[model samples]
Target: MHEDAARAFYAAVDEGAYDQLEELLTPEFVHDRPDQTLRGREAFISFMRDERPLTETRHDIEAVYVGESELAVRGTLRDADDERLLKFVDVHEGEARISAITTYTTQVASRLTEQ
Candidate 1:
């Protein structure tokens, strides 16, 4: 169930289930990515719920690595058409609830920028 938190985070975002997010993340959660750094759960949730450009995308998890107090998930983000937009590794740090997430992403095309 702990490992599921990483997967659930993505599921909640893709499903736009903001309520589920609160259960998975702590109040001081932060998301650090290439494009932006979102501090606090509210800021991260706000971006996912309202500001994310590719709102209809799905995250296909390829692997899950669980550490003592951390988790790393490798996956590809795909559009509704199933086109691979980017490959990513999200490193989540915390114990019971996620406190921070650092994302690394790779893409061949700049298709996302076109959006």
Candidate 2:
């Protein structure tokens, strides 16, 4: 179930269906990345609209592992043209609705400023 939710979440991102994410994420949902942490689903949506990071993304889901309190997803982020940009593992927490997200990706981290 969580695996499906994770896939749906990524699918929403790839399709730019920002509104669709509301159903998959909790009101207090948090998105954690190497560079920043967005608290609340609204904050996350705002970031998505502002940054548009996944505009060219199409996640090639490698696997989804169900953990005690989280679902771990491994995948390669590809561009619209099917070019792999980076590999990542995202931890999704909570049941029914995703409450928290923690992403680990070295490729994206290297792009962040030291400051």
Q: Give the candidate number with the greatest lDDT.
A: 1
Tens-digit per-residue lDDT, 3-110, candidate 2: 889999998887878989888999999999877899999989887766654466688888899987798999988766777777899999998999999999847723
What lDDT score is found at residue 49 in candidate 1? 80
Model 1, position 61, has a per-residue lDDT of: 93
Per-model TM values vs. the true structure: 0.91, 0.87
**After superposing candidate 2, which stretches have Cα over 4 Å from the reference?**
109-115
Colliding residue pairs in candidate 1: none
Each prediction's RMSD to truth: 1.9, 2.7
Cα lDDT tens digits for candidate 1, 43-98: 98888787776788899999999888888899999988999998999999998889
| Candidate 2 minimal-lDDT segment of 10 residues | 106-115
